[model samples]
Target: MAVLKLSGTLNSEPQGKSHPEAGSDSSLSFLHGTKLAYASNLVRDWHADLLHYQGLKPGSAKLHRDNLLRLLNHARVAPWELQKDHVTRYFESRVNQETGQMLAPATVGTYCAAWRGFQNYMLTAERVNELFSEFNVRPKAFVDDDNSIAVKRHKLNWVPKGWALTDLEIDAIDETFRSEIARAAREHSKSLLPLLRDRVMFHVGIHFALRISELTELRVSSFCASLDADLQHFGKWGVLTVTGKGDVTGSVPMRDPSVHGLIEWYTNSVRQKILLRRKSKTEDDGRREIKGQMVSVSDLMFPSERGGVVCPNGFRKRLADIAMKSGVLRRKLTPHTLRHTGCTLMVPLYSPEIAQKYMRHKHLHTTLYYYHPTPLGAANEVNSAAQLFDDEEED
Candidate 1:
C-alpha cells in the first residue's frame, strides 16, 4: 500500500532556528517544508517506530509509514516554522482507501494529534488548529443525527461514552448464547460450532474489556497454556500479548471462563480439523492435505473454514450475530460494545481507577466516562417537583 507522497523544497524560514550543529535551515525543510519547531528526537523516534509498527498490519502501516517518512524527510527542521494549515492539509488529503468520501476531520485530527504530539513533545508549543479541524462525518447511506459519529476534541470527553448494556440487555445476551454455545458444542460433538466461538468472544470482549484489535491479534500461541491456569501466577491464562492501536503492547490475562471453554474447544478439537483441512492438497492421488506441512500457531486461533487466519471483519460479524441472535445487546451489537460493557461490569467489581488500569487507558477522565448515568429529563422533573411543592404549600 502506498500513500500519496508529500513533496516540497527546502527553503529557509527567517523565523526558523538552525539545529545547533547544522549549517542553515535552507537545507532542512522537510514534510514538504512542514516540520514544526516543537519536535524533538524522542518524539521523532516514537513517530518513526509507530509508523514501522503499522506495517505489520495489512493496510494501515503503509499510510502511517508514508506519513512517518514524510515527517522524517523533514525531521531536521525546528518545530516553530511548521504551520498548522500545512499540518491540516497533510491530514485532510483525500484517499480512495478508508472510504471513497473525503477523510473525516476526526481522522485528520488523529493525524494532527500525532503531528502535534511530535511538535509539542519537542516543545514547539503549537496546537494543530486554532480549533480542531476534525469532524465526525456521516455517511450518505445515512440518517438524521450522527450518533454513530466520531467527535472533534470539542471537549475533554468529546467521545461521549456509551452506556453499558443494561442489566436486562446483559441477561438477554447471556441467555441467547448459553444455549447457542451448548448447541454448538453438541452439534459438532467432536468440534465446537461457530456459535461457540461467538459466545466465547462475548465473554472475552465484554467481561474482559478487550478492544477487538487486541482480540483479533490473538493467536493460538496467545492461549497455549491450560485454561485452568492460576491467576496469581504471572503469564498464566494463555498470556495473550496484544499490540493495540498506536502499536502499544499490553499483556492481558485471558482469564474469562467463557474464553477458556472456547479456546479449549478450538485447540483440542477445532484446531485438529483446521490443520487437517489446511494440510489437504491434491497429490498424485488427487487429495489436498498438508502431508508435509510446516505449521505454527500463526496458523490460526480461530481460522476460517478454509483454514486461513480469521480477519477482523469476519470476527466482528460473527461476534455481532452472536449478540444479536442471543439478545445481549438490544441494538446491533458491535465488537466495541463489549469493551464498553466490560468497563461497566468492572464498575461494581473494581474502583474506577483499577478499571482504567485494566483497560490500559492513558487518562482517568477517559476511564470515568465509562460509567453511564440514567438520563433524566430536566424540564419535566423540575416542573413536576414545583407543582407538587405548590400543591403541598396551599394545603
Candidate 2:
C-alpha cells in the first residue's frame, strides 16, 4: 500500500518491501509495490496493443512507450491520477535543451495523439475500472482540444519562407549538385560516392514526391528501367514504384532524363560498390511475411555504409548540408520540402485529378492543399482571368 503524504497525495516512490507474489522481473525488482511499477506494466500492455491491434512496428510502438514514460517520470504520479493540466504543462514546458527553442507545433501534436490513443485504451479496456478502484482515482481524458496543437490543415505559415521551393531554387539545387559532382570527379575525391547517393536521393525523392519513409523503404528492384516503346510519352519514361503509408502502392513515371541517368549510374555502379564493400547478402528479390501474407521485400535502394536502409535523420542532415552548399534560403531540407516542391511543380503540368493520382492521395483535397497553397492569394488567378479576355480581344 502507498503511504499518503501530509498533502493528501501518495508518494510515487517505490517502497522498501518487495512483492514476490505480484511478479518477478529482476530488472524491475526495485520498482515492485510502487505505483510507478504498476504504471510501467500498464505501458507494457499498451505497447502490446499498439503492435497487435494498431499494427505499429516495434520501433514506433517503443516511441509511444517512451513518450508516456517521460510523462510518468515527470509527473511523479500514478497513471489514473494524471489530469489534463499535467499533460498540458508537460508539452508546454518541452524545449530543445541544446538550442533553447520550444518544440514545434507538429511534434507537440504527435505527442498529443499518442497520449490520446493510450488514454482511450485505458478507459475502454476490460477490468481497467477495477484496477483503478484500488487507487480510488478515476481515469479521465488527459489530452483535449484546449492543449492540443493538432490542425486539420497544414501550417505552412509556421515556416515564414515556406516549405516548398520555387522553380529557381529547384534549378539552383540541381545545378549546384552537378557542379559539385563534376569538381569531385575531376579531383578524384573520396566524397564522390556519398555526393552521388545524396544527389540520387534528392532527384528521385523530388520527382516521386515521396515521403522520407517511402523513400527509405524503396528496394533495389523498385525501379523499372524500361517501358513499352508503344506507350507514347510514357514510353521513354522509367517507372519508380513504392509502397507508401497504409500499405498503398503507387508508381510515378520518371520523365527527367538527368534524373533517369542518375538512377542508372547509381544503381549500376555506386550501389554495387557499397554492397561489395560491406559484403552484404541482401537480395533484390526477397520475401517476408506480413500480417500472415507473403510479400516481397528486398535490399534498400539507398543502403547505409553497413548495408541497411539509410537512416532518415542521416539523409535529412546530408540534404541540409547540400542545401547549405547550394546557398539555398532554407538550409534544412526535409523530405516533405522536396515533396512540396515536386507537387507544386506538377500542379500546372497536370490536372488536379492526375496530380492526386500521382501523389497517391486518397482525396483530391489533400493534393490541392499540399500543391496549391495560395500564398500569393488571388493575384495570379486575377491576372490569368484578365489574360483570357486579352486573348479574346486579339482574336
Candidate 3:
C-alpha cells in the first residue's frame, strides 16, 4: 500500500468554529508541505462534489471531513493503506472521551457511513488500484446486514434506567422549572429571563422531541404561526420546520397547547428582556461576534446573554443543574433524556407510527427500538390474555 508520510498534528481546535475570512485557505497547520496541500485539495474537492451532486449542506459535508480526518490521524497511514479491519478497529475504540462509555451504535454507524463516502470518493478519483481494491475496504463489513450495529430489544419487564425518563418525572421537572420562574419573577431576580428561557427550552425539547443541536439552532422564523393572527389569539396549531440529521428538513406540527403558550410567553415577554439586556452591552465588549459576523436577536430563538446563539454545552449544564435541583439527580438528565421520554410516552398513547413521526425518525424500526413496551404495558397484555382464556373456557 502506498503510504503518504504527512507531517503535522490534526487540527485539535473545536469543531464547527468558522474561519476568520471568507474563502481563505486555512491549510491544516499540523500538516507539512505537499502532503498538506494534497490532503486539503482532496477534502475541498470532495466537499464541493457533495454539495453540487448530493445537495449536501456545508455543515453535513464538514462532518464527513472531520470523520475522515479522525481516521487519518488515528491510522497514520495513507488512504490507500486503510483496510476494512482498520476501519472496524477505529470504531471499536470510540468511547466517550469524558465518560469512558461506549458510544451508541447509531453514532458508530454514522462514522461507518462517512468512511464509506470517502472510499467511494477515492474510487471515483481513480486512486484505487490492485493494491487498494474497493472490495478489500468495503464499509459494509464494519456493520451488520441492516447497516447498523445490532442493538437488542429491551426485556419485556424492563423499565427506564437512566436511558430515558418517565412521564411523571417529566411532569416533575416541568413543575420545578415553572415554580422557579415564578419565584424569580416575584423577587425581581436577574435570573428571571434565564429561568424563563430554560423553561421554554424544556418545553421545546420534550414536546418536539428535538435534538439539542436542532433545539439550539432554532430561529424565531422557524415557527410558522398563521397570518392575520395575533400572538395571544393564535391557537396551538402551527408547523415547525426542523432541520434534522443528514440535513433533512421536516415539518413537525405543534399540537401541545402548553408548548404554544410557552412560546408565546418567551417571545412576547422573556425574549424581549434578553434582547434588551444584550442591547445594553457595548460594542467594544466583544459580545457581538458569532462565527465571525454580528448576529441579531431576531435571528435566534434562544440567544445567549452575549447576543449570540446559546452554546449547546452550556444549555445542557443548566438543564443538569435544574434536574439536580428538582431532586431527580439519580441519573444524568440530558436533552436526549427528554427526547426519549417523549417518544416512549407517545408509543403508549398513540401507535408506533405516530411515535415515529413525532420523534422525526426516518425509519419506523428506530422508533420501535427505543419505545418498546414497559412493565405496566406487559402486565396489561397479560391480564387481557387471561380474560380471553376465561371467555373461551366459558364458551
Candidate 4:
C-alpha cells in the first residue's frame, strides 16, 4: 500500500506505532490503525481529482478537503458507512453548539456542499455501495420572508443609521489629509509618498463610491484624461474604469477638478519620487535585484514601500488613523462609510436613479438603502407646498 501525503499540515496524528498495512510513509502515520485511514486516502485522491479533472485551484481544493475532513471526523464513519442520520446528527450537534442561535445559511450550505461533493465522488468512483447513494444532506431554508426555501434574502433597504458623514465631518476629513500633505511637503519627509497616495485614495473612494478592493486594485491604465487620447498625460476631467463586484466594469467620471488635479500631481510627481527612492534604496542595499516589471509606475495605483501591491489591511489602518485625527469615531469610519457618504449625498444632489448609476448598483433597491433624506430637503418640500396653498388663497 502506497501512503499518500496531503498538502498542508494535519492538526493531529493517530496515536502509537504505525500499522504495517499503513506503509512506512510518515505523512500516512496520522492514519495508522484508524477506520478513517482509507477514507482519508480517498479524500486525498478526491483532492487530486479536483485539481486535475475539475480544474480547481489549490486553495479551493484545500477548502473542500478541510470541510470534508470535519464531517468525516465528526461522523467517525467510512464513506460507504455514512448514513443520512449520521450527517443530520452532525448538523444538529453543530446547531446545538451555537446555543439556540441559528447557524448562517451559508455556513450550513458549505457543510452540505462538501459532504455532497464527497459522496458524489465516491459514487462515481464505485467506492461506495448503493446504500449511500441516496443520502441527502442539506441546509434548511433561511429566508427573510420565512417563505423562500432555496435562497436567503437580506433586507434591501438596510443601512446603518448615521453611517454617512456630515458636511463638517467631510470637511474635517479633507482637512486632515490636506494637513498631512502640507506637513510632508514642508518637512520633506520620507512619508510624503504615502500622504499623497492616501489623499488620492480618499478622493477616489468618496467620489466613485468604490469598494476597497476596487480602489486598491486600480492601475494607471484604469484612469484616463480627456486630453490624453493615450494614458500619457492627465487631463482636467478624468475618467476611471473600475471592475466592481459581479465582475461588472463601469466608468466613473471624475468631475471634481480638484480630484483630477490631485491625481494628476500624484501620478506625475509624487509617484515618481517614491519609485526613485525605492530604486535608490534597493541599489544601495545590494540584497536582491528589484524586478524590472515591478519598476513601472503604471503597474499598481498604490504600491507599498517595497514597491509591491498595498495590502488592504494597511489601507484600512491608514484610513482609521486619518479618521481618528479628523476627530471622527474610528469605528464609524470605514471604506464603506465613505461609499455610503457618496451615495447619501448623491440622492439629494442628483436623483435616486443617478445615485444608482453612479454607485453602479445592480438594483435600485440597494441604492435606496443609502438614500438618506436631509432636513433641508424636507423643509424645502414644506415651503414649496406652503407657497402653493398661499397662491390658491390669493386666486
Candidate 5:
C-alpha cells in the first residue's frame, strides 16, 4: 500500500503536554506535530503491514486505512494523545453532517474493528513498539466489547442496563398494533396490508429471537416444516433456516402459536396483496434493483414500501414508532431489543441450556451474560440465601 504523502508545515508547539523523551527516543518526538504527522505515519505503516504481513487485499487494506484516517481526522490529535474518549465522541457524531443522524451501529462497528487492528499492529510491530516506548507512550486497544456495538447488541447499552421488553409492554404493543390494523380495515386505508406485514415481522422477530438482518432477509423458502421427528424441537411449528452473522446457516425452531400463525396470515393473505399492488405500479416482473442487484420482491417475507428488502433503519424506526404510538416502553427500542427480550423470557420458560441452543450461541456464557438470572431467578437466589442463613442459625 502506498503511503499518504502530504506537504504541510509542522506546528512548533504541540497541543498536548510534552513527554520528555529519554536519549535516542528524543529524535522520534519531533514526528508528533500539531498537524498529526505522527498519526498519518502510523496509519500508513499499519496499512503496509496489513497488505504485506497480514495478507489482506489491497482494497481491504485501503478501507482499513481510510477508516482509521477518518477517526484520526475527527479527533485532531496525535497518536500519543489518542484516548477512548475520542473514539466515543467520534461514534456519537452524526454520519450525515446535515441530517445529524448518528452513525449506524454496523458502520461504527467497522470503524472500531479498523481501530483495533491498528492498535494490535502497533503492539506487535517491533519497530513501532520501540518507537512508542522511546516516547514513553503505549498503544492501547480502546474500542473493545465494552464500548463497541459489534459485540454488544446496542451502543446505548454500553453500561449493561436492562433493555429487554417486559411481558406487559409486549402485550400493550400487540393490542395497539391489532387496534391500528382494525381501524385501518374499518376505514379501508391503504396502510392495512403494510401494518399487517409489520405486525407479523415484529411477532416473528420477538418469538424467534432473530437479528435485524435475519428478520429483514427472510424469504418464503427460508421457512421449513415437516422435518424428521428427530430433527425438530418444536414439532410442526416449523423452523427458520437463516444465514446469520459470519454466513453461518442454522435452523431456528419456531414454537409460538401466534408467531407461526401470524407468518401464515402474512404469507397467505398480506404478502400476495402487496405483490399485486407492486405488479400494478411497476410493469417490471416483480424484480427491482436493490443496492445494485435485481431482486424479486415477491420472494421476500417482509418487502418494503417500494417492494424491496426492508431497510434495517426503517425497520428500527417503525418499531420505535409503534412503541411511541402505543405509549408503552417508549424508550428507544431497536430490533435487537426483541432478541434480548425473547432470550430473557426463554431462560424462565426453558433451561439455560435450551436457551443457549435456541439462541445458537457458540458458548453458554454468552446466553448467561445477556439473558440469564431473570427477575424471578434473582429473587429466588435471594430467598435461597435467606434459607441458608436460617438453617445456619438453627444449627
Candidate 6:
C-alpha cells in the first residue's frame, strides 16, 4: 500500500493483496484459486488426463489429447458445453468392444477430462483472455452452483500405485529359467554367459528391486564397487543414477554377490569372445558407440545379440520360464515381484521410512504392501514360568 501510495497508483480491490503498508503486482489470473476460480495457467493441458489415456491406448499423451478432441468434434459439443458434467457423460456413453459395456469409471475419468480440456481450448479462445476480466472466471460454475454439485477430479492413473513383486514369486521365476536358458544358449550357438546373464538379471532385480527399465538401463560403471583407480574399484558394488517414471532419477545400490558374479562372468566372456574375433568387429579408431568421459558399457549392461537395448518383454519371458521351474511360486512371477521381495526382506531390518528412501517412494504406504511380519500363533513355553514359580497352597 505504501509503495502504491508513493507511486500515485493505489491498487484497487480484487486485484492486489494488501499487507496494510505494501502490495505486489501479479496477473488477475492469480485470483483464480481465490476470487476468480481457475483463471489462467492453472491448467497443465490436463497432462495427467492425457497420460492416463495413453496408458490404455498406445500413443503419446498428446496424441491421446488429439483423439479426445476428435471425439468431441464428432459429438458437436459446444465450447462452453465442455464442462465436467458433459465430459463425464460423453465418456460414460462410450462402449467397450470386448465386453460391450459402458466405459469403466477409471477410463471415463481420464478420457472425458482429456476431451473436455482440448474442446474448451479450441472452441473458447476468449476464455484464456477473459481470465483478466472480473465478470466471468468461475470454473466451479461448470459443475457447481452452491458448491453442492458432485464432480470428480481428473488425473492420470498410469504407473499404478500397488505393483511390487514378492520374493517367493521372483525366486520361482529365477529357478524356472536356469536349465532352459542354458539349453537355449547351447542351441543358438551363443555363449553360456547368457545363463549367467539371466541369473544376474533375476538376482539384481530381486535383491535391489529395481524397475525393469532401471535394470536394463544399468551400466558397468554402476556395478563398480570403487571409483579410485589406484584403490582397486573393480569387483566392488557401485551406485548409479536411474531415471524412472516422469523422468525422476534415483540412486539405487546393488548388494547381491550373485549379481556381480554373473556380470563378471558375462564381461569376461565378452572380452574372450571379442579376442576370438568371430563377427564384424567395431573399429576402435572410428566413431565408437560410447561417448563422454566415462566409457559407456556398450549402451547397456545387458544388450541383445544385435548389441542393441535388450527387449524388455524378452527378458520377462526368460525370467517367467525361470520362475515356473523354480519352486518358489506355483504361478507365474514377474520382475516386479523381485521388487516386492526386496522390500519384504527389508521389513525386519529397517523402518518403513528407510525402506522408502532406498526404494525412492513418495509414500511409505506403497512400501507397506510388501512388508508382512510373522504372527505369534503359539508360545514356545507351553507351561508358563508362573506355573513353575506358583506358591503351593496348604493342603
Instruction: Report the lDDT of model 2 for residue 352.
Output: 56
Clashes (candidate 6): 17
The lDDT, on a scale of 0 to 1, for candidate 4 is: 0.62
Error of 6 at 77 (Å): 6.5
Identify the leading candidate in terms of TM-score: 3
Residue 313's lDDT within candidate 5 is 88
lDDT tens digits, residue span 2-60, model 6: 11112332212343635321122223322434433342233333445456643423345
If both were scored by lDDT, which would come out higher, candidate 1 or candidate 2? 2
Clashing pairs in model 4?
Answer: none
Candidate 3: C-alpha RMSD after superposition: 10.1
Candidate 6 accuracy as TM-score: 0.57
Candidate 1, 1-395: lDDT as tens digits: 23332222231123454442122222334434223322344344545555564334434433433343344444333343444444433334444445445445455444444454444433422233411222122112111113212233334345664657766776677687776667766666533544555556566677567787666545555543434447534233555655566455655555456556655665676556655655334532322222233444334555545554446687777667666676445566777877887876664455555666677776665655565533453123322222322322110
Cα lDDT computed for each candidate against the true fold = 0.50, 0.66, 0.64, 0.62, 0.68, 0.50
Backbone clashes for every candidate come to 23, 0, 1, 0, 0, 17
Report the lDDT of model 2 for residue 99: 56
**How would you encode candidate 2's per-residue C-alpha lDDT over 320-343 as one tens digit per residue?**
776788896655777788888787
Give a tens-digit lDDT track for model 4, residues 83-153: 66665655555443224544455565555666667767876534543334433322222112222221233
Residue 274 shift from truth in candidate 6, angstroms = 7.7
Off by over 4 Å in 1: 1-153, 156-163, 178-192, 223-239, 254-266, 269-271, 277-295, 373-395
Instruction: Give the 10-residue window scoring lowest on summed lDDT in candidate 5.
Output: 3-12
